[model samples]
Target: MNHEFSVAEVMTTQGGTMCQYTEMTDAARKRVRAMHNWRRSQLALGNVQNGRNNYNCSQAANMYKMKYDCDLEKSALDYAKQCTLTPSVAYNQGENVHVGPLENDKTKAIATVGEKCTHWSTVIRSSEKKGYPGKTVNSTFFQAVKAWWGQIFRNGVNQRMIFLQNLRDKPNAPIAWSQMAWALSTRIGCAVVNCQSNTFTVCRYRQE
Candidate 1:
Protein backbone atom coordinates (compact mmCIF):
# COMPACT_ATOMS: atom_id res chain seq x y z
CA MET A 1 0.00 0.00 0.00
CA ASN A 2 1.95 2.99 -1.24
CA HIS A 3 1.00 6.45 -0.18
CA GLU A 4 1.96 8.99 -2.79
CA PHE A 5 4.23 11.86 -1.79
CA SER A 6 5.34 14.89 -3.71
CA VAL A 7 8.95 14.54 -4.84
CA ALA A 8 11.31 14.65 -1.86
CA GLU A 9 14.27 16.90 -2.62
CA VAL A 10 17.64 17.92 -1.26
CA MET A 11 18.92 21.44 -1.14
CA THR A 12 22.45 22.75 -0.81
CA THR A 13 23.26 25.46 1.67
CA GLN A 14 26.47 27.09 2.78
CA GLY A 15 26.83 24.52 5.52
CA GLY A 16 26.08 21.38 3.48
CA THR A 17 23.38 19.45 1.68
CA MET A 18 20.12 19.42 3.59
CA CYS A 19 17.34 16.89 3.29
CA GLN A 20 14.08 18.67 2.81
CA TYR A 21 12.15 15.48 2.72
CA THR A 22 8.51 15.30 1.77
CA GLU A 23 8.71 11.62 2.65
CA MET A 24 11.24 8.84 2.71
CA THR A 25 12.04 7.34 -0.66
CA ASP A 26 11.54 3.65 -1.38
CA ALA A 27 15.28 3.11 -0.97
CA ALA A 28 15.26 4.69 2.47
CA ARG A 29 12.36 2.52 3.55
CA LYS A 30 14.09 -0.59 2.31
CA ARG A 31 17.30 0.30 4.10
CA VAL A 32 15.51 0.75 7.42
CA ARG A 33 13.48 -2.44 7.01
CA ALA A 34 16.57 -4.48 6.15
CA MET A 35 18.48 -3.20 9.15
CA HIS A 36 15.69 -4.23 11.51
CA ASN A 37 15.08 -7.66 10.02
CA TRP A 38 18.79 -8.42 10.07
CA ARG A 39 18.92 -7.78 13.79
CA ARG A 40 15.82 -9.85 14.36
CA SER A 41 17.27 -12.66 12.28
CA GLN A 42 20.48 -12.61 14.29
CA LEU A 43 18.49 -13.03 17.48
CA ALA A 44 16.31 -15.76 16.03
CA LEU A 45 19.44 -17.66 15.01
CA GLY A 46 20.96 -17.40 18.48
CA ASN A 47 23.81 -15.38 16.98
CA VAL A 48 23.37 -12.54 19.42
CA GLN A 49 25.55 -12.52 22.53
CA ASN A 50 24.20 -12.29 26.04
CA GLY A 51 26.24 -9.34 27.34
CA ARG A 52 26.23 -10.93 30.81
CA ASN A 53 28.50 -13.94 30.22
CA ASN A 54 29.23 -14.15 26.48
CA TYR A 55 26.53 -16.81 26.64
CA ASN A 56 24.89 -17.92 23.42
CA CYS A 57 21.42 -16.43 23.34
CA SER A 58 18.32 -18.51 22.77
CA GLN A 59 16.77 -18.58 19.34
CA ALA A 60 13.30 -17.32 18.59
CA ALA A 61 11.44 -20.20 16.99
CA ASN A 62 8.77 -18.08 15.36
CA MET A 63 10.25 -14.69 14.60
CA TYR A 64 8.66 -13.24 11.49
CA LYS A 65 10.47 -11.09 8.97
CA MET A 66 9.14 -7.54 8.90
CA LYS A 67 7.68 -5.54 6.03
CA TYR A 68 7.46 -1.82 5.47
CA ASP A 69 4.09 -0.19 5.92
CA CYS A 70 3.46 3.09 4.10
CA ASP A 71 0.72 3.91 6.54
CA LEU A 72 3.05 3.41 9.47
CA GLU A 73 5.63 5.61 7.81
CA LYS A 74 3.11 8.35 7.22
CA SER A 75 1.99 8.24 10.81
CA ALA A 76 5.59 8.24 12.03
CA LEU A 77 6.61 11.06 9.72
CA ASP A 78 3.71 13.22 10.85
CA TYR A 79 4.81 12.89 14.44
CA ALA A 80 8.54 13.16 13.78
CA LYS A 81 8.19 16.42 11.90
CA GLN A 82 6.86 17.93 15.09
CA CYS A 83 10.39 17.64 16.54
CA THR A 84 8.94 17.49 20.02
CA LEU A 85 11.51 15.02 21.35
CA THR A 86 8.66 13.00 22.82
CA PRO A 87 6.70 9.88 21.97
CA SER A 88 3.34 10.10 20.23
CA VAL A 89 0.84 9.60 23.00
CA ALA A 90 -2.16 10.20 20.75
CA TYR A 91 -1.47 7.42 18.26
CA ASN A 92 -0.58 4.83 20.92
CA GLN A 93 1.75 3.12 18.51
CA GLY A 94 4.95 1.10 19.03
CA GLU A 95 7.63 3.71 18.63
CA ASN A 96 11.37 4.31 19.01
CA VAL A 97 12.78 7.82 18.93
CA HIS A 98 16.43 8.88 18.75
CA VAL A 99 17.66 12.47 19.04
CA GLY A 100 21.15 13.14 17.81
CA PRO A 101 23.29 16.00 16.62
CA LEU A 102 21.71 17.70 13.66
CA GLU A 103 22.55 15.80 10.51
CA ASN A 104 21.37 17.18 7.21
CA ASP A 105 22.29 14.16 5.11
CA LYS A 106 19.33 11.83 4.98
CA THR A 107 21.50 8.77 4.42
CA LYS A 108 23.71 9.61 7.38
CA ALA A 109 20.68 10.33 9.52
CA ILE A 110 19.21 6.94 8.75
CA ALA A 111 22.55 5.25 9.36
CA THR A 112 22.82 6.92 12.74
CA VAL A 113 19.49 5.37 13.65
CA GLY A 114 20.87 2.01 12.57
CA GLU A 115 23.93 2.59 14.73
CA LYS A 116 21.72 2.96 17.78
CA CYS A 117 20.84 -0.68 17.34
CA THR A 118 24.34 -1.56 18.57
CA HIS A 119 23.22 -0.33 21.94
CA TRP A 120 19.87 -2.05 21.50
CA SER A 121 21.36 -5.35 20.37
CA THR A 122 23.26 -6.46 23.48
CA VAL A 123 21.46 -7.54 26.65
CA ILE A 124 23.04 -7.10 30.09
CA ARG A 125 22.28 -7.24 33.79
CA SER A 126 20.59 -4.32 35.40
CA SER A 127 19.68 -3.33 38.93
CA GLU A 128 16.06 -4.54 38.67
CA LYS A 129 14.88 -7.62 40.57
CA LYS A 130 11.96 -8.75 38.39
CA GLY A 131 14.86 -9.99 36.24
CA TYR A 132 14.35 -7.41 33.46
CA PRO A 133 15.02 -4.05 34.95
CA GLY A 134 13.83 -1.20 32.73
CA LYS A 135 16.19 1.75 32.43
CA THR A 136 15.55 5.30 31.38
CA VAL A 137 16.80 5.41 27.77
CA ASN A 138 15.41 8.71 26.54
CA SER A 139 12.74 6.80 24.63
CA THR A 140 15.32 5.98 21.97
CA PHE A 141 16.03 2.95 19.79
CA PHE A 142 18.44 1.52 22.39
CA GLN A 143 15.65 1.48 24.93
CA ALA A 144 13.30 -0.26 22.53
CA VAL A 145 15.86 -2.99 21.85
CA LYS A 146 16.50 -3.46 25.54
CA ALA A 147 12.81 -3.75 26.24
CA TRP A 148 12.31 -6.18 23.37
CA TRP A 149 15.32 -8.55 23.61
CA GLY A 150 16.61 -8.08 27.14
CA GLN A 151 13.64 -9.35 29.09
CA ILE A 152 13.45 -12.70 27.34
CA PHE A 153 16.94 -13.67 28.52
CA ARG A 154 16.72 -11.80 31.78
CA ASN A 155 13.62 -13.67 32.89
CA GLY A 156 14.79 -17.00 31.44
CA VAL A 157 11.63 -17.31 29.37
CA ASN A 158 11.05 -17.90 25.69
CA GLN A 159 10.37 -14.82 23.60
CA ARG A 160 6.88 -15.98 22.80
CA MET A 161 6.06 -16.62 26.43
CA ILE A 162 7.23 -13.20 27.56
CA PHE A 163 5.14 -11.63 24.82
CA LEU A 164 2.03 -13.20 26.31
CA GLN A 165 2.95 -11.84 29.70
CA ASN A 166 3.67 -8.44 28.14
CA LEU A 167 0.13 -8.25 26.83
CA ARG A 168 -1.11 -8.38 30.40
CA ASP A 169 1.72 -6.15 31.66
CA LYS A 170 1.10 -3.12 29.47
CA PRO A 171 1.72 0.49 30.59
CA ASN A 172 4.28 -0.94 33.02
CA ALA A 173 6.39 -3.17 30.82
CA PRO A 174 8.64 -1.77 28.08
CA ILE A 175 6.23 -2.61 25.27
CA ALA A 176 8.37 -1.12 22.49
CA TRP A 177 10.81 -4.05 22.59
CA SER A 178 8.05 -6.63 22.58
CA GLN A 179 6.37 -4.83 19.75
CA MET A 180 9.57 -4.97 17.70
CA ALA A 181 9.99 -8.70 18.22
CA TRP A 182 6.28 -9.58 18.26
CA ALA A 183 5.90 -12.81 16.28
CA LEU A 184 2.76 -11.56 14.61
CA SER A 185 3.91 -8.02 13.90
CA THR A 186 4.94 -8.01 10.27
CA ARG A 187 5.15 -4.33 9.41
CA ILE A 188 7.03 -1.17 10.38
CA GLY A 189 7.46 2.45 9.19
CA CYS A 190 10.06 5.02 10.06
CA ALA A 191 11.06 8.64 9.45
CA VAL A 192 14.01 10.92 10.16
CA VAL A 193 13.18 14.56 10.81
CA ASN A 194 16.04 17.06 10.91
CA CYS A 195 15.37 20.02 13.10
CA GLN A 196 17.63 23.03 13.46
CA SER A 197 19.96 21.52 16.02
CA ASN A 198 18.93 17.89 16.24
CA THR A 199 17.63 15.01 14.22
CA PHE A 200 14.69 12.93 15.37
CA THR A 201 14.66 9.41 13.96
CA VAL A 202 11.43 7.59 14.68
CA CYS A 203 10.26 4.12 13.74
CA ARG A 204 6.72 2.85 14.39
CA TYR A 205 5.72 -0.80 14.30
CA ARG A 206 2.39 -2.49 13.71
CA GLN A 207 0.90 -3.90 16.89
CA GLU A 208 -0.65 -7.34 16.90
Candidate 2:
Protein backbone atom coordinates (compact mmCIF):
# COMPACT_ATOMS: atom_id res chain seq x y z
CA MET A 1 0.00 0.00 0.00
CA ASN A 2 3.01 2.26 0.44
CA HIS A 3 4.33 3.62 -2.89
CA GLU A 4 6.55 6.45 -1.58
CA PHE A 5 10.09 5.87 -2.84
CA SER A 6 13.54 5.89 -1.31
CA VAL A 7 16.97 5.25 -2.77
CA ALA A 8 17.96 1.60 -2.35
CA GLU A 9 21.69 0.95 -2.05
CA VAL A 10 24.14 -1.48 -0.54
CA MET A 11 26.72 0.07 1.75
CA THR A 12 29.78 -0.97 3.73
CA THR A 13 31.71 0.78 6.51
CA GLN A 14 35.45 0.57 7.06
CA GLY A 15 38.12 2.76 8.72
CA GLY A 16 35.29 4.71 10.37
CA THR A 17 34.11 5.73 6.92
CA MET A 18 30.92 4.70 5.17
CA CYS A 19 31.02 3.91 1.49
CA GLN A 20 28.11 3.03 -0.77
CA TYR A 21 28.40 -0.46 -2.23
CA THR A 22 26.08 -2.77 -4.17
CA GLU A 23 25.48 -6.32 -3.03
CA MET A 24 22.47 -8.53 -2.70
CA THR A 25 21.16 -9.53 0.75
CA ASP A 26 18.23 -11.66 1.80
CA ALA A 27 16.58 -8.66 3.45
CA ALA A 28 17.37 -6.49 0.46
CA ARG A 29 15.97 -9.18 -1.78
CA LYS A 30 12.78 -9.18 0.26
CA ARG A 31 12.62 -5.42 -0.10
CA VAL A 32 13.10 -5.75 -3.83
CA ARG A 33 10.26 -8.22 -4.05
CA ALA A 34 8.10 -5.87 -2.02
CA MET A 35 9.02 -2.92 -4.22
CA HIS A 36 8.35 -4.80 -7.42
CA ASN A 37 5.04 -6.02 -6.04
CA TRP A 38 4.07 -2.48 -5.19
CA ARG A 39 5.09 -1.25 -8.63
CA ARG A 40 3.20 -4.02 -10.40
CA SER A 41 0.14 -3.31 -8.28
CA GLN A 42 0.29 0.34 -9.23
CA LEU A 43 0.59 -0.56 -12.87
CA ALA A 44 -2.34 -2.94 -12.61
CA LEU A 45 -4.43 -0.29 -10.90
CA GLY A 46 -3.47 2.21 -13.59
CA ASN A 47 -4.57 -0.19 -16.29
CA VAL A 48 -7.88 -0.87 -14.56
CA GLN A 49 -8.43 2.83 -13.99
CA ASN A 50 -7.77 3.48 -17.68
CA GLY A 51 -9.57 0.39 -18.99
CA ARG A 52 -6.30 -0.28 -20.85
CA ASN A 53 -4.54 -3.54 -21.66
CA ASN A 54 -1.39 -2.74 -19.71
CA TYR A 55 0.99 -0.05 -18.48
CA ASN A 56 4.57 0.61 -19.59
CA CYS A 57 7.26 -0.35 -17.08
CA SER A 58 9.64 2.25 -18.46
CA GLN A 59 7.08 4.94 -17.81
CA ALA A 60 6.50 3.65 -14.28
CA ALA A 61 10.22 3.57 -13.56
CA ASN A 62 10.60 7.13 -14.82
CA MET A 63 7.86 8.28 -12.50
CA TYR A 64 9.60 6.57 -9.59
CA LYS A 65 12.95 8.17 -10.47
CA MET A 66 11.47 11.64 -10.82
CA LYS A 67 9.40 11.37 -7.69
CA TYR A 68 12.02 9.67 -5.53
CA ASP A 69 15.31 10.91 -7.01
CA CYS A 70 16.74 7.41 -7.30
CA ASP A 71 18.78 5.82 -10.11
CA LEU A 72 16.68 3.24 -11.88
CA GLU A 73 19.62 1.18 -13.13
CA LYS A 74 21.15 0.68 -9.72
CA SER A 75 17.81 -0.10 -8.20
CA ALA A 76 16.98 -2.47 -11.02
CA LEU A 77 20.30 -4.25 -10.88
CA ASP A 78 19.92 -4.65 -7.17
CA TYR A 79 16.43 -5.96 -7.71
CA ALA A 80 17.53 -8.34 -10.45
CA LYS A 81 20.29 -9.81 -8.34
CA GLN A 82 17.76 -10.42 -5.61
CA CYS A 83 15.36 -12.06 -8.01
CA THR A 84 18.10 -14.26 -9.36
CA LEU A 85 19.00 -15.52 -5.92
CA THR A 86 15.46 -15.81 -4.67
CA PRO A 87 13.58 -18.73 -6.18
CA SER A 88 10.17 -17.22 -5.39
CA VAL A 89 10.92 -13.93 -7.13
CA ALA A 90 10.79 -13.92 -10.91
CA TYR A 91 10.90 -10.78 -13.06
CA ASN A 92 11.77 -9.85 -16.63
CA GLN A 93 14.78 -7.52 -16.54
CA GLY A 94 14.23 -6.17 -20.05
CA GLU A 95 10.70 -5.13 -19.16
CA ASN A 96 11.72 -3.17 -16.08
CA VAL A 97 13.81 -0.32 -17.49
CA HIS A 98 12.75 3.22 -16.62
CA VAL A 99 12.08 5.56 -19.57
CA GLY A 100 11.04 9.08 -18.32
CA PRO A 101 8.27 11.63 -17.58
CA LEU A 102 6.24 12.04 -20.75
CA GLU A 103 5.08 8.44 -20.84
CA ASN A 104 4.37 8.44 -17.11
CA ASP A 105 2.22 11.53 -17.50
CA LYS A 106 0.32 9.92 -20.37
CA THR A 107 -0.34 6.84 -18.29
CA LYS A 108 -1.64 8.98 -15.43
CA ALA A 109 -3.83 10.93 -17.84
CA ILE A 110 -5.40 7.75 -19.18
CA ALA A 111 -6.10 6.57 -15.64
CA THR A 112 -7.66 9.90 -14.74
CA VAL A 113 -9.96 9.70 -17.74
CA GLY A 114 -11.14 6.27 -16.64
CA GLU A 115 -11.82 7.53 -13.11
CA LYS A 116 -13.83 10.48 -14.43
CA CYS A 117 -15.84 8.19 -16.68
CA THR A 118 -16.75 5.94 -13.76
CA HIS A 119 -17.72 8.93 -11.64
CA TRP A 120 -19.97 10.37 -14.28
CA SER A 121 -21.57 7.01 -14.90
CA THR A 122 -22.35 6.64 -11.21
CA VAL A 123 -23.77 10.14 -10.93
CA ILE A 124 -26.04 9.61 -13.92
CA ARG A 125 -27.36 6.36 -12.50
CA SER A 126 -28.02 7.89 -9.11
CA SER A 127 -29.88 10.85 -10.61
CA GLU A 128 -32.26 8.61 -12.57
CA LYS A 129 -33.89 7.09 -9.52
CA LYS A 130 -36.01 8.62 -6.71
CA GLY A 131 -37.49 6.00 -4.37
CA TYR A 132 -35.44 5.50 -1.27
CA PRO A 133 -33.17 8.11 -2.77
CA GLY A 134 -31.26 7.39 0.38
CA LYS A 135 -30.45 3.91 -0.86
CA THR A 136 -29.37 5.23 -4.24
CA VAL A 137 -27.15 7.79 -2.53
CA ASN A 138 -25.56 5.18 -0.26
CA SER A 139 -25.06 2.85 -3.19
CA THR A 140 -23.23 5.54 -5.14
CA PHE A 141 -20.83 6.33 -2.33
CA PHE A 142 -20.16 2.66 -1.50
CA GLN A 143 -19.60 1.90 -5.19
CA ALA A 144 -16.61 4.25 -5.30
CA VAL A 145 -15.09 2.75 -2.16
CA LYS A 146 -15.72 -0.72 -3.52
CA ALA A 147 -13.92 0.14 -6.77
CA TRP A 148 -10.92 1.15 -4.68
CA TRP A 149 -11.24 -2.03 -2.63
CA GLY A 150 -11.35 -4.07 -5.82
CA GLN A 151 -7.96 -2.67 -6.81
CA ILE A 152 -6.38 -2.87 -3.37
CA PHE A 153 -7.63 -6.35 -2.59
CA ARG A 154 -7.14 -7.67 -6.15
CA ASN A 155 -8.71 -11.13 -6.75
CA GLY A 156 -9.41 -11.86 -3.10
CA VAL A 157 -13.19 -11.71 -3.02
CA ASN A 158 -13.62 -13.42 0.36
CA GLN A 159 -11.06 -11.14 1.93
CA ARG A 160 -12.72 -8.09 0.45
CA MET A 161 -16.13 -9.18 1.62
CA ILE A 162 -14.84 -9.86 5.11
CA PHE A 163 -13.18 -6.44 5.17
CA LEU A 164 -16.36 -4.79 3.95
CA GLN A 165 -18.45 -6.51 6.58
CA ASN A 166 -16.00 -5.52 9.29
CA LEU A 167 -16.08 -1.91 8.12
CA ARG A 168 -19.86 -1.82 8.17
CA ASP A 169 -19.94 -3.31 11.66
CA LYS A 170 -17.06 -1.42 13.20
CA PRO A 171 -17.92 0.29 16.51
CA ASN A 172 -17.23 3.82 15.28
CA ALA A 173 -18.64 2.88 11.89
CA PRO A 174 -16.53 5.42 10.00
CA ILE A 175 -18.11 4.09 6.85
CA ALA A 176 -21.57 5.04 7.98
CA TRP A 177 -23.18 6.53 4.90
CA SER A 178 -26.47 6.66 3.05
CA GLN A 179 -28.21 3.70 1.47
CA MET A 180 -26.86 4.94 -1.85
CA ALA A 181 -23.37 4.51 -0.48
CA TRP A 182 -24.06 0.92 0.53
CA ALA A 183 -25.49 0.23 -2.92
CA LEU A 184 -22.39 1.67 -4.54
CA SER A 185 -20.13 -0.40 -2.30
CA THR A 186 -22.14 -3.50 -3.21
CA ARG A 187 -21.56 -2.83 -6.90
CA ILE A 188 -17.85 -2.48 -6.30
CA GLY A 189 -17.76 -5.69 -4.24
CA CYS A 190 -19.21 -7.49 -7.25
CA ALA A 191 -16.68 -6.04 -9.72
CA VAL A 192 -13.58 -8.07 -8.85
CA VAL A 193 -11.67 -9.80 -11.71
CA ASN A 194 -8.22 -11.05 -12.71
CA CYS A 195 -5.91 -8.12 -13.29
CA GLN A 196 -3.46 -9.74 -15.68
CA SER A 197 -4.36 -10.42 -19.33
CA ASN A 198 -2.53 -12.47 -21.96
CA THR A 199 0.90 -11.04 -22.76
CA PHE A 200 0.52 -11.64 -26.51
CA THR A 201 -2.74 -9.69 -26.61
CA VAL A 202 -1.13 -6.87 -24.73
CA CYS A 203 1.85 -6.79 -27.09
CA ARG A 204 -0.39 -6.73 -30.15
CA TYR A 205 -2.40 -3.85 -28.75
CA ARG A 206 0.79 -1.92 -28.08
CA GLN A 207 1.88 -2.55 -31.67
CA GLU A 208 -1.37 -1.14 -33.00
Top-TM-score structure, candidate number: 1
Tens-place lDDT per residue, model 2, 1-208, is 1212222122111211111332222332233223333433454344322212232212122112111112322333333222121222212211111111223323333334222001111111111112111112222222333433243222221212223665445443322111111111111100100111100000000000
Give the runs in model 2 whose Cα sits over 4 Å from its true position. 1-22, 39-48, 51-93, 99-208
RMSD of each: 12.0, 22.1
lDDT of 1 by residue, 21-116 (tens): 344555556555776797788878887654344465577887889888777777777776666654355354566665443222332333333330
Instruction: Give the least accurate 10-residue stretch of model 2, judged by summed lDDT.
Output: 199-208
Instruction: Give per-model TM-scores.
Output: 0.57, 0.18
Best candidate, lDDT-wise?
Answer: 1
lDDT of candidate 2 vs native?
0.22
Error of 1 at 142 (Å): 12
In terms of lDDT, model 1 sits at 0.48
